[model samples]
Target chain A: MAEYKGVMTYCEIAEGSLPSISREVAGFGRKLADDLGEELCAVLVGSDVGNLAQDAIGLGADTVYVVDDPLLKEYQTDAYLSVMEKVVRKMMPRILILGQTSVGRDLAPMLAFRLDTTATLDCVGLAIDPGTKLLLQTKPVFGGNAQATFTSDFCPQIVTVRDKLMPPPEPDASKQGEVITLDAGLDPAAIRASLLKRVTENEGGVRLEDASIIVSGGRGIGSAEGFDQLQELAALLKGAVGASRPACDNRWLAPNRQVGITGKIVNPDLYIAIALSGSIQHLSGCAQSKSIIAINKDPEAPIFNYADFGVVGDWKKVLPAFRDKLKELLPG
Target chain B: MRIIVCIKQVPDPQASSSGTKVDPEAMRVIVPQGTPPVMSPYDENALEAAIRIKDAHGARVTVISAGRNLAKPVLRKSLASGADELVLLEDAAFEKLDSYATAHLLVAAIREIGEYDLILCGRQAADTDAGQVGSGIAEILKIPCITAASKVELSDGKVLVERVVSDGFEVIEAPMPALVTASSEIGDLRYPKLKDLQAAQKMPITVRGAQALGIDAAGLKRVNLVRLAEPPRRKTECRIIGGETPEEAGANLALKVKEAKLL
Candidate 1:
């Protein structure tokens, strides 16, 4: 039998707490580590974040690396990557995993370049091959038309798993693990870029990627003015508004509201695609939605194949009726 | 100043899957025959940025491409668009090169071309969407790289770039002879003019082999194929239940909203 090294999961911080994606990665990482007969280690870098370190251990990490630094309070790619590079060089783990969030997307490629390694981003699945001990990374490819599995015969195989790929870890507080503290070694001069200001979207609801219910519009929504109806419908459902590439391309909505390969990947519990013809790029983003509702006048629209239910009619006429029915079924 | 723009040709985004599996033996992806190819969207941005820089800084732009012989047409397209010269890095050796190896080959080729004030590439190739090529090139060349750049300006022998960051943006200034990956907003792409298109038809294209780049063709190996599976199917469950009239439907929708626990 071949011996296996441990797995290092980058426990991401969000909303001043451990993001749900971190627990999901930890749960999956724990299973992989257990199968390999190795421990799961979690790494956390933040300012005075020792208290949050235990949650990672309770989730699944057998050991937690805590780098408490005042400079690490906010996410600065250069600073974080610098510390991560130092930590990775010291630990030399077999596999390194992170959540495929915006931060992860920004850091993974840079880190890979720094480490002189290759990383597969937005991975949906991961495992270890028993014979070669290679970490098998699977991710959507070619604008979600296919899934590609990749492996590197190199050390510290890295991947970033998308959110909701795995169930959140069930906490086991009784299972205690060791927590080691380290200084992140962050120097102000090391920071090359300075944050000017953060401009968040003012009308906030659930983020499309993380939302359970999503209502989307497409070119068939007709005009930018038509989006208000979709917004009204989305508000009625307490769901978020998403747009097909055409809608975004037409500037009917913000780029962040676009759902497709170039936009945001969403897997909502219920996805309502309005007046969408279902272009592959648009479908790629919402294909993972638990249940898809496509409302279009064209019955032959490509989106029908991917949708769970279809309503062939004018969206301007159909959406309000559908919204009312949904409201009828689940009244506030 | 000399600027090098790395360009790649990809299938139209609207086209069906032409991606094959990792296992060459069991490859099942049907490469669509007679599919129209386009300059990768990101590469278009790269080309536009290169043209803009050339117009402002009086630099000569060289278009570089790596692919099979079939990529000649794609290379010519770049030349027609405004590039001063074209170099095609073609060989069986580059057939299976991944991002890392591809970057190495490109760096070697660039080194052979001698000094350059700047290198420009798309933030990512549309087909693979790996987004590692530019960064990998920067690493190999040991130059500062700015990725996801929405805006770029040259002043005082330095490149000032606005890199897209989460929440907002950040400005980074690097010295000349830097590599910058361009984002879509860099500039609007221009179509090839009649005169340029006519000239492009007569333009001489230079082709280089992998051996010339110091990479052993046999060393380019694909380790594993992640499976190529169809996208998950989505089922639309849309049903219409309200609206005696359009106005009635809106009122009913309001009532339904209250009933649905969503209001």
Candidate 2:
């Protein structure tokens, strides 16, 4: 293994701009570097991505590594992983931190396999041991019913932090770091997969992860017709519609709209749990929400504890009134 | 063309847990029996994708699964859904293998089945939700893997697939003999007809042991799991806004939301 003694953070760039998760990872990496008394180096791989390297330095990276190649304009798992593997082999950092975005999810596992190491994914917390210099990673397990803490006995500890797990870094204009441009060894034929086209959805609504107001439902919504009421409420409140695991299981909503540890972790300003008995898996994902509202017929439901507001009446009667009240309270 | 789809039977997501105690002798956890075993929801998507491919390309699709004898019911469901053949990798020792060993065992079974043009699997299993087996199998077999595939189209000599990314999707094109993990959006699955179910009962199913696949079940190791326990019960203190009418309850809830600063 290549031997470089520093913490390396993999910064993801999209549309020639840095993603928010990258800064969060950089902040966490800075903390880890401080604890280890080592420099934090940032690695950026993409086409025409050099302009974003300065943002990484502003986020607390002391050094930035850039692999700018035309072949990397689109992410192919094989080509991207090959460049990452080459960089890691050349500069063997003590720890590798990646943002648990889609790219991170695909690349981290492949990189770990190539490096013959283990990668802890979707970590919600991170800490470094001063004496041992080991990275302690914490993540929810068993569909969020439990949390597990793990550490690697091997070198080059790798962890992927879930999005929004850490606060984004505060920028300091006065801080300037060195930028090193490296050649990305690219072989087009080596990339088994090639991109043909990209289709993006146009519908606009609150993104589940970043939404401030989330109005959610569960299996008790009864039918597809019930979703119309939930959607109407979400629209009236300028919020997003989320579903519990049971709702997703019943195909009441798309899996992408599901909220839970296994689904999406949401920290909304107001979380409305409608016709849903809160399960542990669902609670773990929404526990960080500022306020929770439970609307269920069963007065003894588990969601009441997490909910700041509770409505014991049936949703059919409760939701319409609630929607009208919100309209009166905040006219749009 | 022959396509192989590896599936697993897991507890239904909605099933209540079987009351298995973390410390059974000590009376720790009472996880009631979870829902009955069924073809994993994700795997059903994979199976549906495979069936679509067969219908469009006239390909032979084989459904392969690993589990206890109780899994026969679940395996029959796959057969009823239009799989041309069924193979069950069964053994008492196969029950406890982790994802790594599971991948190895599946690879051995695939090798025993001879050459195949393509392989498909669910992105992850519902029970463990590991999302590792498909990738691990691809790694072991040294083949290209496209995961979380939202769309797949085959033409000429290449297979085109769109894998879901965080911000967007990354479209990938791979040659035959590639592996893909189906996402939920692959297609909507159809329920089996009565005729299909009856025909599935007459379909031949080949059951094999781990030894037949050249995997030493004894070598499999459990990395962790001191015990299993039920998740802690959530405590709820219901604050019933006692009101004679729904509007009064709505007002009371509005007050609570304002006090909580949820507005």
RMSD (Cα, Å) for all candidates, in order, is 3.8, 3.8
Native contacts recovered, in order, as a fraction for each? 0.34, 0.30
Model 2, A159-196: lDDT tens digits are 78887665697887678899999999788887886677
What is the iRMSD of the candidate numbered 1? Answer: 4.7
Off by over 4 Å in 1: A1-4, A187-190, A193-197, A320-332, B17-25, B56-58, B153-177, B185-188, B217-223, B231-263
The lDDT per prediction is: 0.75, 0.77
Worst 10 residues of 2 chain A by lDDT: A140-149
As a whole number from 0 to 100, the lDDT of residue A286 in candidate 1 is 76
Where model 2 places Cα greater than 4 Å from the true spot, the runs are A1-5, A35-38, A127-137, A150-156, A219-232, A244-256, A277-281, A298-302, B17-31, B67-70, B91-96, B167-172, B187-189, B193-204, B216-238, B245-248
Indicate the residue-level lDDT of A128 in model 1. Answer: 80
lDDT of 2 at B123: 78
Q: Best by lDDT, which number?
A: 2
**Tens digits of per-residue lDDT for model 1, A62-103:** 999999899888776668888998888778778889887667
User: Per-residue CA lDDT of candidate 2, range B103-135, in tens?
Assistant: 778888898888887899987776665566777
